[model samples]
Each structure stands twice: as structure tokens, then as C-alpha cells.
Target: MFKSILAAFDGSEGSEAALSKAAELAILCGAELTVLTMYRHHSVLEGSMYVTNADQPDDVDAIMSNHAKATAERGAALARQAGCEKIRAFVKGGPTARTIVGFAKEHDNDLIVMGSRGLGSIEGYLLGSVSHKVTSLAQCPVLLV
Candidate 1:
């Protein structure tokens, strides 16, 4: 039985599936459920950085972080709805695969679940196929949804 379970979400349908699955597992095992969302802080427009990734005037990073955090919160809610007793929401800033793997390892999670894919390359580093990399690099067992 998984004692500590981590679920990664990015507001996608696949991520929703992963969250639901994790919730079910948590309920079954009476395991702790944690939801993780990784965010990035875009650099300035100049100095080898793409204009699209530049820091926007309207706090786009904040909005994205909020969205991701909300996704995690919703996952926690689902865990509660599924009768999970220990539920948590986590949001971190950095590369997705690294942040997620690090979080899982640091928290000693027995299971890691995430969506199969994400937004796109232009949007973020972990937007596409990041789940595959996390599965390859993570120390614990990873279930790609």
C-alpha cells in the first residue's frame, strides 16, 4: 500500500484523470494525498530570452501559478471527496520534472501520478512530454495518466 501519494496536475483532462486515480488509491490505502503544480519565473525580455517568455506587465506568472495552485487545491478536494483523510496542495517554482521529482523524493512519496502531456513547448518547459521525463528520472514509482 502506498503511504504517501503525489499527484501532478496542470488543469488538463489527463491530469484530472490522474488526480481522480490518486484520490481513489489514497482512499483505499488510507494514504496521504498531495497535489503538486510546478511553475516558472520568466526572465526579462532581453538577454538571450525569448520575448514571448519575458515577464509580462500583468503578472502572467502569478496568474499561471494561481491556476496551477487552484488545480492542486481541486485535486485535494477530490481526495477529500473520495474519503482521503490526509490531503495537501503544493505549488513550486522551477522546472516541472525536476520540481515534481524532487518533491516526491523529499516527501517520501510511494507513488507519483501525472498527466501524459501538457500545454506545448512555447508555453513552458514541462508543457509537453514532461511526464515521460519525470517517470524516467523520479526515484519512486510513477504512473503516467
Candidate 2:
């Protein structure tokens, strides 16, 4: 039985499935569920390359981080609605697969549940999916939903 479960959520359809599965497993195993939402840091170089709205917030990175935190909170709420009693939500900024695996290892999560594909960019096709990288990198068991 898993004592701590980690779920990588990004508010996508696949992630929604993973969240539901994680909640079910958490309830069954009586484990504490941790929902993680990771977003890439918006670099100043990227922002400079793209035109910004005059009324847009100047702190773009903070805005993106806040959005990720909100997404994690929503995922945690869904888990609670799905009957998971012990739940926590976290948000981070980094590469998705590395962030998920690193958080799982640092937190000593027994199992990782995540989507097969997330809201990835074109690099996913050139490189690989986040789930694939996570399965290869993670020390614990990983379930892709």
C-alpha cells in the first residue's frame, strides 16, 4: 500500500483522469495525496520576443505561477470530492518531468500517478512526453493514466 501518493496535474483531460485515479488509490490505500501543478518559468527573453499588452501585468512569471497554483488547488478539490481525505496541493516552476520526479523523491512519495500527455509544447514531439521522461527518471512506481 502506498503511504504517500503524488499526482501530476495540469488541468488537461488526461491529467483529470490521472487525478481521479490517484484519488481512488489514495482512498483505498489510506494514503496522503499530493497534487502537483508545475509551470515553466516565463523568461524575460521570451517576453521580449513577444509583444505584451499595454494593460497586461508586468509580473508575467508571477501570474503564470499563480495560475499553476490555482490549477493545483482545483485538482486537490476534485480529489476531495472523489473521497480523498488527506490531500495537499503544490505548485512549482521547472521542467515538468524533472519537477515531478524530483518532488516525488524529495517528498518520499511511494507512488506517482500522472497523465500520459500534458499541455506540452512542440518540443514534446521532438523529444518525448513528460510521462515518458518521468517513468525513466523516477525511482518509485509511476502510473500513467
Query: TM-score of every model?
Result: 0.81, 0.91
lDDT of each: 0.79, 0.90
- The residue-by-residue lDDT of candidate 1 on 28-137, one tens digit each, is 88898898877776554432344333454355566667777887787777768877789889999888888899999999999998877765364434434688779789
All models, RMSD in angstroms: 4.4, 2.0
Best by TM-score: 2
Model 2 clash count equals 0
Model 2 lDDT tens row, 1-145:
8999999999988899999999999999999999999988867877666655677666677777878988999999999999999999999999888989999999999999998877886666643389899999999999988
Roughly what TM-score does model 1 have, to 2 decimal places? 0.81
Q: Where in model 2 is the C-alpha error above 4 Å?
A: 50-56, 122-128
